[model samples]
Target: MNVPAPAHLLSLATASPSHSMRQDEVLEAATQLFDGRFPQFERMAPVFKHAGVLTRQLAMPVEWYLQPRTWPERSAVYDEVALDLFCEAARRALDEAGLTGAEIDVIVTVSSTGLSTPSLQARAIARMGFRPDAAGIPVFGLGCAGGATGLGLAARLATAQPGCRVLLVCVELCSVAFRMEDFSKVDIISTAIFGDGAAACVLSTGADGFAAVAGYAEHTWPDTLDIMGWRVRPDGLAVVLARALPPFVRKEIRLAMERMLASQGLTVEDVDRFICHPGGMKVIEAIEGAFGLGQGALDRERDVLADHGNMSSPTVLFALDRIRQAGLPRRSVVTAMGPGFTTSTVTLAA
Candidate 1:
């Protein structure tokens, strides 16, 4: 028989600023960037300003990243930024789990927006003072599903070893990829949305962790690669988020949920709490509409979205941390969407 891990979520460390940017500031800046290329966006000033985003936090000050020569610097800014987030989050997760570096048998780090050799997990193990021989699972290109996928992999590790302990950290430096020159609809949409942040959790074989991840499912939509991805150009990495995503979620989410639940011998009715990734207002709205959930089903999601925007892989974990803190009834389900037009779901019991 497989033994389940006593995995609990740790305190989340966000990279956004505490002070909210004023609507005027956002519009004035956006207008300056898009005045000629996307003149139509000027009409969206009011809508964009109030579009469910009241405030957000960034890992670094805006000017430090938005400077003219920042992107061209050959200093490998991506790895450093990713390292900062990973180290902070690993510290918090280890503290929360009440375990030191030597106790962890495995380290799984996930990211889609950054690249690093010796990867985040290795650097984290070294900097965070974990044992040198701790196995490292560095997952890249998992996109938004990276967090839950990390959990899924960690759970398997816990199940494999009778007393194994695993740490999963998700870090995204999305702010580093902002496009001021390309003012297309996709650019504007991604700019107004994606934010930088990190979230981490610890899984253990003993029932001493925060909560237990009971089951999970992963699926991808083929032929939909173009729905969302990054394109490499001489200028830099460009984002592509299709307008069809909102409609796709509205139409296919229910079917996906049904399959996800059935795979674990569950149904939506059996789930007491729902922790969903707040991809955006449209994605949340699509989820609510498809699931027929009450208004409150998304209250926490709306709160996170208003506060942090979307931090990619860490987004769903952010919501799950809220659910864990709120002390909601047990038997919850956490779900998220990602590139590959994929969906990931994990069932947990508090």
Candidate 2:
């Protein structure tokens, strides 16, 4: 395989909806909605407290999630709210990069929460002041891995054409897909961890700003399709989270990463830091164990999870943003596991 052309990340920014709910507030709502029907629900209630999420922002107030909504109704809210986040994150990223929408040559948009006909970039052309000629590469179904993957994609596309600027945007309205009408453990787990948010990254060979993309690779195991993903539901989208995920990650993640890095002519020992998607409290701990780090060593990952829950694809970029603010390491690897039971790793050179 050809090595990707070197490209610098100009800026990274994240945005969230205004409706905030702390764990206690979310617990109260869950109790109200699930207590009467799920007799076993109380036994599983402890997940909220131990989930390590202090608060999360949702596209709509908790009141809206309590009612039943049709697919059309849910998608309407998704289209509206997701686009607003797309614009906000995109604008902030461009401003931080000292560039405007007109300067962008490509838009790589990633999402899977809800369907939109025109996709976000096309819909926002007028509002965002993007050139009608700017090409859009809308990616779907990458789930939580989209941030690193999208960043890698943008870096490649930007460097594909000299002086080209590519803006990568990841938006997920996970809360909008929360459907309690059909009962399942995954639904409850999704409530405990999922949140609505978006993150954007601008990349080019134009100039060094933050870090340059080195390489990106993915590893997927056979017969692991059931680990994590979404299922289409008549109401909206159903969350599919398997209980076996944390253990699976702990067992396989290290070797998987070793292979990925070796393929790039590097080794795990060469990485100064490992920035991983905080899939959950267990998954975070699993990542630490995979790298032989002591428990709770990934404090920043914990902080992002505590603050934002899991915004799926955008979560890793949030971690990356914090890592950049703290100070970039000489060599860092941004990674995440999502649907396809895949682990995607993107190397960054500071």
By summed lDDT, the worst window of 10 consecutive residues in model 2 runs over 2-11
**lDDT (tens digit, per residue) of candidate 2 on 1-350:** 97545899999999999999999999999999999888778998999999999999999987898899999989899889999999999999999999999989999999989789889999889888999889999999999988878887887788788679999999999998887787888777888998989999899987887898888898989998888888887787888889998888889999999999999999888999999899899999888988898798788889999999999999999999999999989899999988998888889999
lDDT of 1: 0.74
Local accuracy of candidate 1 as per-residue lDDT tens digits, 317-341: 8877776678856798888888898
User: What lDDT score goes with residue 320 in model 2?
Assistant: 93
Candidate 1 regions exceeding 4 Å error are 1-24, 65-75
Q: Using TM-score, give the best candidate's number.
A: 2
| Runs of candidate 2 exceeding 4 Å displacement | 1-5
